[model samples]
Target: MKGDDDASVVVAGVRVGSFTRDSFVDRVLTMARGDSTRVAVGVNAHVCNLARTDARLREALSTSTTYADGQSVVWAARLLGGHLPERLATTDIAEPILRAAAAEGLPVYFLGAAEGVAERAAELLRDRIPGLRLRTHHGYISEGDVSLVLDEIAAHGTRILFVGMGDPAQQYWVENHRDRLPAAVLTCGGLFDWLSGSNRRAPAWMITSGLEWLWRLMIEPRRLARRYIVGNPAFIAAVLRQRRHETPRRTPSGVL
Candidate 1:
């Protein structure tokens, strides 16, 4: 909130902030140390495609500080003649974020994931990050009964809240409750699974070569097949169409 330079790029109609991992963590901590409320969200190809038709999700993203969580999204930013520092996947950067919060003595909350997943993640993080004041609640609560969870969060005096309910649901919850939540709220899809050791990250080579999607597909083929097979192609096509419609800029020489 304090150091937000408002630097961002629009890719396929979704806005993503241009911040390196370091800068991003710093900004979120800054917000956590502040009195004002803010929200952070990460956008991937699946999120972009979903936002194409989900007006509420679009609004949620439009109002939050958005970042590129997908390598494909970073690639699309470049293709659109814009630049994102790099992909800042929440799982990849969770350590630094949590460490910073711990260092700052900020109380943090982890809300989402299966019944025991969040609690396990908090336990591991507490061991890894000493002085980390963290709490958790499973994401299985009924939508209409979120007030109880909100009350628990407020009682903890949380300064940074991470929600891993996934996609539109997480974003929707943040948007609907932003006013009531204090400090910084971030939407972290599947982060709890990775942190709790229920899921593993792709191998370094796959991640570096941007084949992590393939790895994820391999690991959870049935659950993610449509998302990768269909969503990936659709995202490419959408960016291509956006590229085709844009008029190219000209130099003084007027060479075309």
Candidate 2:
């Protein structure tokens, strides 16, 4: 991965890389090359919104390899003079990571999303990347059933685990189970839904203009109105305030 010279601030002790999608992928791939396990967290508007008041959640988010998931974050980074090129949506990242895994013969496990979504996503991935070794466990299982899911992942010898249980839940799962699992996990929210065609993504133009949230609000107005309209702005203000109170820090040039 090419080194980025942009400024980086430490949030909850995690040194987030202020880089574009390609650089972020390179950095993640470099982390994948190491002996120790590494986990990556994709922070979208919802997660960022949650991170504002939840200090423990922020600390957990800081522990993983963090990437900008919402265009708002990309814009904020640019405003902070980092120049992040594009939003790295996990729905998009999933394809590239699966392609890379297929090429490297890595075993991947899909965890989360509604009952058939993960399975359908695995099927879609196989169609996209022939001969890909992938396993999946649906996200609708009860909390009591988590043990069985964990056991299945361990049995499959999963190298990469793509989690799609949404924020806080996905992050909490990864944090609690990271020590027990042998695989490197990536917390991806609703990615399976998008991949399975259960949830449609907004048009590219809307996403580019950071109006994807608006599109989502239009689709699920009652459910998403407070989140996008009210929660997002509050989160942005919190991030800016945090940035103002801190100084940029350098991350070690190696895997987590």
Candidate 3:
């Protein structure tokens, strides 16, 4: 095992890449150039942490390039003997990638989020990325209705698809439909809501310190209090244990 230096690593037969937000977009663009087949891109964090439990998901993640979406994950990586520069929030990553896609003439499709959110997000993205090919599919459809959604994407010639219905669901959707779509899929939880102006992100300082979770808890205390206040602490404890027991792996560049 090599140290982390923005390169890919194979864990449990899956190839996982250590990427910042910028590198993630670049790599996906690279993948899109050769084959517009569906590819999964994860924004790593504790809430969406599948690396510890599910071997397939870990392998899927390893085979895909996972970006450090949350500050907590980046901090944990550093603590667990990996070197990472910063947290690449998915919300921040989406627009820039869309802009790049537009510049390169790559068509993008938005999947997930409530009715109208996807459409609104497309509009917002178009404003930023002029002449960008953007399409949307709402999140309220029935599970059996996925075939219709798949058909729409196939017709659109979508090179990139953003899944914003939150994790596990978004992750599952991408995994289940990767074979049917001709696009690279990135799981972006709640990003559509933020882009559509329905949800406001916390201040930069809070995000930098990994306390954005706290800000979210404050916004919807009754809903998120238990998850962040109690669940996250336990999650942190588990990560600490894993860090202590696992040996640091060096990267191909020899950095640990």
Clashes of each: 0, 0, 7
Stretches of candidate 2 above 4 Å error?
1-3, 6-15, 239-256
Worst 10 residues of 1 by lDDT: 247-256
Q: What is the Cα-based lDDT of residue 226 in candidate 3?
A: 71
lDDT against the true structure, per candidate, is: 0.84, 0.72, 0.68
> Which pairs of residues clash in candidate 1, taking residues 3 or more apart in a chain or in different chains?
none
- Rank candidates by TM-score, best first: 1, 2, 3
**Model 3 ranges off by over 4 Å:** 1-16, 36-38, 48-56, 251-256
Q: What's the TM-score of each model vs. the native?
A: 0.92, 0.86, 0.86
Q: What is candidate 3's lDDT per residue for 1-256, written digit by digit as tens? A: 1223645432222233476666667767776675646455544444444455766665456445565666766666666666556767778878878888888999888888889988987887788778899999888879789899989988998888887776556666677777887647778878888889888889989987788988888888997677677766765776667656767552442120
- lDDT winner among the candidates? 1
Identify the superior model by lDDT, candidate 1 or candidate 3. Answer: 1
**Tens digit of lDDT per residue, candidate 2, span 1-256?**
2236544534323345455666766666566555566778776667777776778788786566777677777666555445545677877777877777778777888988877788997898898797699998888878798888889987886778888877788777778877766547788877888889888899989987888888889988998889888988776776677668766334442322
TM-score of 3: 0.86
Ranked by lDDT, top first: 1, 2, 3
